[model samples]
Target: MTVLKAADELEEIVARVGPTAARLLTRGEEETMPEIAEALGMTEKAARARPTHYEHLDS
Candidate 1:
């Protein structure tokens, strides 16, 4: 499969879950961010910013 850019991955996540929905999925779920971010080929930072995606590794 072709690799995706960070911005593109971010967009995809938001498109799938929406900002609000993504947050609901991630709330209090800090343990899952690293795996999800890696799966999306993004740093923890970019992934967290995708609408309601995980917040951050440093949090």
Candidate 2:
């Protein structure tokens, strides 16, 4: 993918999940996958995928 396209995708992902992630971090709450999925309005499977995606970005 092009640099611009990759940046845009990263921006979109942050917009979608950044709030929930920040809230969870500040609250210091341990949440289950189902709880996270509910908070994000996503299926559990999709929620599970997010950590892997983040890990990839981290690396």
Candidate 3:
């Protein structure tokens, strides 16, 4: 997915679930990767990479 789409999806997930859950989702553990990917219409790798992707957005 595009960087903007990834950032938007990550922002939505954080808004819905809070930063703690968002952080866990980015870890790609406990099946969170697939779930987050489906929820955000992104790939598992995109979901897994969101936290780091966000870091770059801020810089």
lDDT tens digits, residues 1-59, model 3? 69999999988775555645555545657566687789989987887776665544332
Cα lDDT, model 1, residue 30: 86
Once model 2 is optimally superposed onto the true structure by TM-score, how far is the C-alpha of residue 4 displaced, in angstroms? 9.1
Candidate 2: lDDT of 51? 63
RMSD for each model, in Å, please? 8.6, 6.0, 7.9
- lDDT per residue for candidate 2 within 11-59, as digits (tens), equals 9798677666644543533457678879999997887767655444432
List the candidates' TM-scores in order: 0.47, 0.48, 0.44
| lDDT ranking, best first | 2, 3, 1
Clashes of each: 2, 0, 0
- CA lDDT of every candidate: 0.65, 0.67, 0.67
lDDT measured at residue 29 in model 3 versus the true structure, 0 to 100: 70
- Give lDDT: candidate 1, residue 24: 66
Alpha carbon lDDT of residue 32, candidate 3? 66
Q: Tell me model 2's lDDT, rounded to 2 decimals.
A: 0.67
Q: Which 10-residue window of candidate 3 scores lowest in summed lDDT? A: 50-59
Q: Write the per-residue lDDT of candidate 1 for residues 1-59, one digit (tens) a residue.
A: 34568778877675655645666647755887787789989998887776433333223
